[model samples]
Target: MSESKRMDPFTGEKVEVDGVYENEAGQEEELHRGDAFPADLILGNTEWKLTEMSFDNHHEGRTDERLVPKEKDIDKQGKIDSPRRQMDRGKK
Candidate 1:
């Protein structure tokens, strides 16, 4: 029999596979491969365990925002502020 895959990723850690992860509080989040685990606002940093693997075979070359590290100058609303936005602001 094949062994079941187990993954327990912490906040700021890179996810090894695309899947759904659950925290100690039972909250779930879907994280893609190569994306960093996020920290909970109320719980701060917590360990996350993989609950399911992605069955998606489609690869459209798109990645979620979690691919970027949390320290990369995201806005208060958790949106990434791209360099293009800076240039646009300068033009105003």
Candidate 2:
């Protein structure tokens, strides 16, 4: 049998391909290209492996600003405001 393509993706990493990914716990998630891998609430960070490729041709390889990663915003204090940090701003 041919070797299966395996990916080493971590939480917060950009999804390089549109496909179904399986984590170490055997949990599967369908992620589109350019989307960030989400952290597992219970397991925290886990490695992801691409299991299946998506054949959807709706976009036809077109790039979307909403789907791609954005530049980090810097606050007045010169601190980079990441998505997680922005969400935690009011908690502190």
Cα deviation at 46, candidate 1, in Å, is 0.3
Model 1 regions lying over 4 Å from their true place: 1-7, 57-92
lDDT of 2 by residue, 1-92 (tens): 34566548898899999999988888999999899988888898988988989876546667654444456633333433355544354555
Using all chains and alpha carbons, the TM-scores for the candidates as numbered come to: 0.53, 0.53
As a TM-score, model 2 comes out at 0.53
lDDT of 2 at 56: 66
Instruction: List model 1 lDDT by residue over 1-92, tens digit each.
Output: 34566546789999999999998778999999999999988899999989988876537646665645466555534444575533343544
Query: How many clashes in each structure?
Result: 0, 0
The worst-scoring run of ten residues by lDDT in candidate 2 lies at 73-82
lDDT of 2 at 66: 49
